[model samples]
Target: MSDAQFVQIVGAVYEHSPWVAERVVSQRPFASAEALRSAMRRAVQQAGEAQQIKLVRAHPELAGTAAARGEMTAASTSEQGGAGLNQLTPEELARLQSLNARYSEKFGFPFVMAVRGHDRQAIFAAMTQRLNNDRDTELRNSLEQIDRVVSFRLNDLISG
Candidate 1:
């Protein structure tokens, strides 16, 4: 893929961090979709603890202010919408915000998830369960979710 297209494809995959794509652009002519994904994963891994947290935090809370105001990226909007986060009732939105505030307070980052096959109940259950985890564990889980999100994006934009 051309440089611009490469960035266009993977940039939103990493939340607002186009630098992830920019950093990996020179390593292009990716052998396969998985190869491209691994390169993106390594970019996050190499970013170290602080940067990793920053990247995770770059994501807006599901059905929160960004979604309500329509300020989220198109990819994020669609992902959250797919999970039914976009259609929450006021009570549901309040519950999610309460959970989100608690989760962020505990982990210092927003709860991250792929949200493809998940519904609001599953998401709330996961959020409540994940809140019990220690910081490091939650961070690892966040990275795994980010990987899943990236993979989904790659599968959408790139073909093997």
Candidate 2:
């Protein structure tokens, strides 16, 4: 795709995911690929509380439940279930489910991650580790990670 088409797709994606709308729209007509990436990182860094919440909500749940409903991307769904969250055997699934339930209940949302290349055990460990964070810090970190994931995905979409 040309730069203009890339801009359009990025803009639409930002709008579709409201969390990134203002940032994506505001940084239109990027002069270089690096500039576009920098803008995205800055957008996430400067995102307000509401935008952050929207971003978190846009991500699939930790156990891949929301993903199966088409609310999340197919690639994310597969990654979450097939690897990062998938290593749990039935017993382990139950244990992780308990942990996930507790974590979400504490945070008011499901645990979110960009699990493109993670294994289930690794994700599980990360989940446990992240649960140690206070709500504010974890929320910020999670959204930043989501923005990174989206940016990478956008680059792929545009390049292809």
TM-score, per-candidate, Cα-based: 0.94, 0.77
Question: What's the lDDT for all of these models?
Answer: 0.90, 0.67
lDDT of 1 by residue, 53-148 (tens): 999999999888888788998888989999999889989999999999999999899999999989999999999999999999999999999999
Q: In lDDT terms, which candidate is top?
A: 1
Candidate 2 residue-wise lDDT, 1-160, digit = tens: 5545555566443424633544565556779766776777677667777766776766666665654355655556555666646456777777777877877888876677776777777777888898899999888777767765676566766687
Task: Please give the lDDT score at residue 54 for candidate 1.
Answer: 91
Estimate the overall C-alpha local distance difference test score of candidate 2.
0.67
Clashing pairs in 1: none
Off by over 4 Å in 1: 1-5
How big is the positional error of residue 5 in model 1, measured in Å on the Cα after superposition?
4.3
User: In model 2, what are the clashing residue pairs, if there are any?
Assistant: 83-120, 84-119, 84-120
